[model samples]
Target chain A: MSTQTDTRSSAVVAGSFEGDPRRYLRGLGGLLVFLLVWWVGAMTTQPSYLVPGPLDSVRAFIDLFATTTAIVVPVSGSDLVLPTGLAHLTETLFHYVPGLLLGASCGVSLGLAMGWNGALDDWLRPLVRVLRPIPPLAWVVFAIVWFGIHHTGAAFIVFVGAFWINFYGAYGGVEGVSTDLTDAASTLGVERDLSMLKLVALPSAAPQVLTGFRTSIGRCWMIVVGAELFGAPGVGYEIINASNNLAMATSVAYMFLISLAFLCMDVGFRLLEGRVLAWR
Target chain B: MALSSESSVDRESREKITVRNVSRAYDSTQALEGVSLSVGEGEFCCIVGPSGCGKTTLLRAIAGLDDPDGGSILVGGDPVTGPGLDRGMVFQEYALFPWRTVRGNVRFGLDRPACDCADCEARVRELIDLVGLDGFEDAYPKELSGGMKQRVGIARALAPDPEILLMDEPFGSVDARTRDRLHAELLDIWAQTGQTVVFVTHDIDEAVTLADRVVVMDAEPGSVQSTFSIGIERPRERTSREFVDYVARIRDELGSPIDTIE
Candidate 1:
């Protein structure tokens, strides 16, 4: 430890924006190869609907946004016209955003509380163990029965998926906080319990907690699609509905839409994580 | 316990810290046994001993981070029930909060909300300058050298203006040259602040260089073996005959390692 020299703000030279072009070109080359293979598979298939070439999927994707659909607003009792692509995307976000936000918040809070308090941890441990193994999909039956085939029902499944990941992430983080740090805080006039937790343990555990949240961000997207498959109005429904009609290209296009949405969200989340967990 | 009120008042005025027959055992092992010591106001006292001598346990007991199974610790005539702001501690690992910058770590003991107020910022800036880390206020612990980190730790402990400073082998991890520099800086700070400091270390030379009075302890139910007062003046030469004599005498009292090995 003593041998290490100070190496901060010095490793990176100014105005050196040079990044390796070969790596970027290589990634582009890989994508082109994948597209070629997919095109060949589409050509050889007995029916074009069975396999979608990249070009066909792209065309279908464009048509989804170009076309308009009438959506009935339940609260306003009015018919709203929006692009087909946006209507379904909005439906997915309706559940996905709320479910993830609510579940992750509750999970993080409870996990921190339980991890910090020994008696709370003991009391909750058995219940968490029992509930953890039951898959999120297994709750679809209860979600439909309890909330009906509405956005709330689909949101519940997404919530369940997000909750567990964040709980374990926060719990493990708090559990791993070094006792030396807390002892240091205690001597510095910060009392034990909540203040120590907020000032010392929370910051210590932040990297892990944020990593879990990022993981859930991607996971909930996958769960969002699954939740909407059971007659809820969203991109997942469009994918299944198009497939039943043998419009495989449209199904693949909606699948692409989901992928693009997830990518955008993941990138945005990474930027936020970089700012918040800069100390790591 | 039987001391008269008049003598107790004098003791309180003269002594900054008093540990009375403090005993602590961990499960099957006795970590500290009937240890008693007093540190005078504004005194620099170092506890020197071999490994497992409960020097750290005794320091923790004094810091109120740990409680003795039997006996008590008093700071400013008040019984130490738990860790309080009157005493500040520095650890060997330089346990600065990794999430905070050098300025943040130093300002932590101030017990104020992190605000942009002039008074708080000036106090923090003064501490940073005092520790000779003027330009590196925004640097995190991971970006710092071991010496710099320990300096931050020292600054943080001093920020609260505590009456007593407790340190546990705070310079153990730094290189020798850095340790010597830190020794001088610590002495300078001690002179400036006049806070009674109790430092624990295994290095005999460190004890000799930094301590006004060195307390030697022995293992196997750790207890104080003896105490030596160095009459050497400020910035005493390590090579001087008097300084060398004190180190040798303290080493002799510690019992040479060959005796333990045999």
Candidate 2:
């Protein structure tokens, strides 16, 4: 009897596994159709400069890694040549990583404090209400004045974008926690206020908190590209430079690189999130 | 077991719980009005009432999760001020932390200052087995059925081995068949633990089957209306005439004579 039940359950599992690959195939087929339409449109456009085909973009992307670009050395004030793709990509990450980490951490901590404590909510609500309305791009002037036209200035803008997303996510998550969970924790001997927050409130709000982190990551990526328009290093700067030089294919290639980077990071984060919240 | 053994001598001599004129009000609505009850060590008491009877409020008060507006509650002769480790509570919703596995949830109460790491794991394992959730130790609460989740909740509550257990409509959410099995399992655990249990439910039949004594409560003002002593033997037969009589008496006390006929 037990063996029969086991076989039935395993068959059900096998059925689901079969369904997954078919779903992936459908998704891949859709992407191919999209690419075909894009190729036809590019072929009809006058001058390859106006609308570069997928082949042109792909070639430009490969050439970017193989070729070098000359840049003025900051310390010695001498000309130096470096690999364009690697140098620009590293520069973007230097600012993006720091800004995202700093902003998300600060926002989540403050939001949790505000949501959990009535006094903190009252004190900070008005300030957040006033500041959150201002766009992250609006801080570019202040960024330039504070840190000059550098990676630090660009990073500051990315930080502003990431902050609000995480703040609201964590705040709403904490507020959504059911009172029954807290009461259960209390009876389970976690009577202290701090202990209750750590054990019950935080874990209960984790799904929301993780959602906030995921959103902030995507938002920060977009903001970093815009922020780099202010004379910072990275793919954004490369795209702007290529466009100015009328290298439309190169500009499009840089755009694709940014998207590819975002996709890789997003997949990595989703895997981590799956592992962290496996209990769900 | 070492913890229980050390406290066993003191446990036999002490009074389990004393609730004296405990009154709690929310705004103008009185949830509980001057309720008084005392339970002896190792006693199984069930509090039954109609909807909005404040049975849950009373159980929360006993667990020290809520403060009474008037009078006091004591466990083992000590005034109940706040939730303490000596009193464990099982909620109607099971309230198992969704993020924690069955064993992790059971280990939560034992991960206190009073318990060491190795001892806590042992106690968790023992409680998991006691609640018949041995193979499901690593399973998340979401993966379990309603009955299984409540079993985890019961194991979690029992892991600390409190002198008193306060449960608020614990098996009310499960199906009738599952609830019947749970009742038998609960009695077996209660017999082994020898802890004072105060269970709150709206089901008269459940009270009659499980309780040594039933405290019937009224709604609106929310006060204890009457008490009935059940002399039925263990592994109670629901179809038995004595059991039916006990259920009828409690239903009459609830002021619902029509329900008895039904």
Candidate 3:
């Protein structure tokens, strides 16, 4: 019996080490290996311009922060100079934050309402089904027509992309709430329909709703970059401009910047989610 | 015992529950049929039966969580229309909200318009202490054991100070030792509060152990088979001949084939 217990304890110890930290270390190792192979490939290539090394990309990234661009102020007709990196990044965030906030809030509210209320679900489901299939980029022409070639137009496109993801998230969350929970609340004197929804249904659906929020955060970042590809001043536009000018290293640098920004946002959101769902 | 043969009119005046000709059906299955029983004020009544028996259905109907197809259920001389604050129920699964802390779950029912803030807080704290969960008030439901979770369930049910406490197989999930402890605690609470309790269970020993009167029920259109009064006093010895006799009688009435086979 003691020997069997020792074997079981050893197995448990082995199982614990097999998770999380080891997996993270393996991921980091794989990334380093990939970078090494890319660097080697770049050195072996025929021309340096075709495949700039990792060091060249890092230099280009630094240059973006140092470089300034001169633009004529539209309203004042004055020469205004700004760092290209800061200006483009600020422009992207201006649209991205407001658009994501607006779309996510509206979508979650509507989705929860529709999921909770049978009448609202019947009224809105068909319209949503018809509209959901049309891609957000398809609204670019309409956005440009309505808001013109400005921040609002780009924001509108990003909103369209984020809205659908949040809508589905909240809808599924509310639908997934077990009937047993609602009955429990009813016995606890939360019998009114509105109160039941508020007290029981909403909290029960929070994990799924938060999952929707997290997913939309990643999705909005992707959409914002795509939205900026069309005459909008963001990292995506910088990448296109650099590649067009045969500065492939600069293009790759901007791509890395976008990825870094996404990683920061994703990690931050995951931490917040962990704190909120600590009970689970 | 003398109260059992009293007319409906006289019994209704003093009894906490007067379930008369109550019947319920789910689609094609007759869950309950013409079930009638009366529980006196502050009486501890346990309904025992086999699987497929409509004990849970009857308890749910009494709690006003479900509606009966026919007949009337009266609590304190009023017809049970729907779920109200006057009836508190403890579920078998210990349905304490996962997100809410022990205090928060207990406070759920106390946040009504009828209860003042200070009084509600005091009552919640009192119940937390009464259920032997004073130190763990801030702990979430997931952090608790099966027995501890059911204690939270009891505390949450008692928070509103309801007159009628309905428990459906509340200790069925707990181990025997934990269940024994819970039974003692529950009886103490019941004696202190003077609340009418209608407990449903499949375990005959459990019914005999906890109930003042053991109500035996038959399945397949579930109806009351017979009623046995347990005159044995509090903290009743499980090994006592009287206790064993009560358990055996109830088991026999419940149609347990173990005794017959032996």
Candidate 4:
């Protein structure tokens, strides 16, 4: 009896919405339903100030860009005017970018080293395990004390958040490197430990490393907002200040900004990942 | 047959590889014990055995990918301390670097100073052509079929222009038709490059088809059982009486079919 099916199966499962037009319509439908529910909830609330309508929040979001603020330029020592939303957003980015980049760099390096070297793993594993569970926000007290609630203080919190994610990603990736590959490399005249790691292990571990970095990118943004909540100048500060003033719609607007920023970064990174990991 | 008879006198004088009393053990079980064999220069030698026969282990020792627990393996009068560019290896699984393209994989073994130079690029192109993978130089290993991937493995191994080519069932995974085509292509490559080859396989017909000398092995503390010389000429007719006779003799020498089942 023949075992083959009459028709070939598609790679994507049945009913999958990837690259399909219906998925877009469905997404728009979902957003509309959510907005309707939100609007109904706002009408039922005891005080309208507690739960502003989606329209009010949208107006507040637009106002952020229309308003301008003056700030002293560090390099030029001159006053520069920028849109209110952008002024705070730039301050958040100043710490978020450097913190994620530096922490990810150090974490990946250390993780790769530990994964490759058994002795180093043994030496550092205990310390890492003890420090790993302490939340990034918990370090805020120390950050404020050490860096004086400036960008550096918020940056340190973001760094802590980024470091552990990337560390585990790189560590697990290197640990999972195939012995078959290493043996093949050995036969091909790559014998030294460092050379083996570079020529064989590193490339093999690349997908995992990139995956970890991607995860950290999203996680670090969450940390940035939390870090800014304690009187640091950013969207988080705006969120807290607006809520304290009972301008709840302004707080919701900044929250939406955070989500939009995260979505943009995630989409950009995904495109880059697609290019980098095309072989996979 | 006549050609092999004529060359027999000179074969003893050009011993390229000498494995002298090699022994290896894993934990409690002995994989190989006091096994000794020699291959002449430019010779095509195949080792055939059942599962657990340590054929791959012996091949790995020759490649210097593994160290024998006892005894020594000498290639071209020098002891094999570790893997070197002098010897190239082809694995059954086609262990290609997935991240690298066909061109990149083939260029892996080239000396660092020669990399990215015009000559190096030419050499990579030449190897890709040799393995019949000319148009697929830009393709990744994941994109290739089983036969194509093995071809890339062969091209990558030959990139360094080694003196000895050691293969462990390099065509075992491919289908019968592809395996036959690869066999002919491999023989053609072997003839063009006069490198000594030590191939290992479990297939009797395969060993009969490719090897100038087939060495049969037995498992459970694996050691050599017998050796047979195939005097048949190139492009051997598999259905011919002489070819069938050789296959029968070797199969008989391998012992009962029941012994090989497990």
Against the true structure, what is every candidate's RMSD? 4.8, 4.0, 5.8, 4.3
**Model 2 chain B poorest ten-residue lDDT run:** B1-10
Cα interface RMSD of each candidate: 4.5, 5.4, 9.2, 7.7
DockQ of 1: 0.40
Please, what is the whole-model Cα lDDT of each candidate in the order they appear?
A: 0.86, 0.83, 0.83, 0.86
Chain A TM-score per model, please list them.
0.92, 0.87, 0.86, 0.91
Please give, for residues B14-81, the per-residue lDDT of candidate 2 as tens digits.
56888899899999889999898877787789998877778899998888878899999988888988
Clashing pairs in 1: none
Of models 1 and 2, which has the larger lDDT?
1
lDDT string for model 1 (B123-209, tens) is 889888887888888988877778888999999998888899999999989888888888888988877777789999988888999
CAPRI tier for the interface of model 1: acceptable
What residue runs in model 4 are displaced by over 4 Å at the alpha carbon? A1-19, A71-80, B1-12, B113-116, B256-262
In order of listing, the candidates' clash counts read 0, 0, 0, 0
Write down the worst ten-residue block by lDDT for model 1 chain A. Answer: A1-10
Superposed on the true chain A, the predicted chain A of model 4 yields a TM-score of 0.91
| Candidate 3 structure quality by residue, lDDT tens digits, A71-172 | 444336577677877667766776888888888888889889999999999998999999999998889899889997567888898888888888888898
Docking quality category of candidate 4 according to DockQ thresholds: acceptable
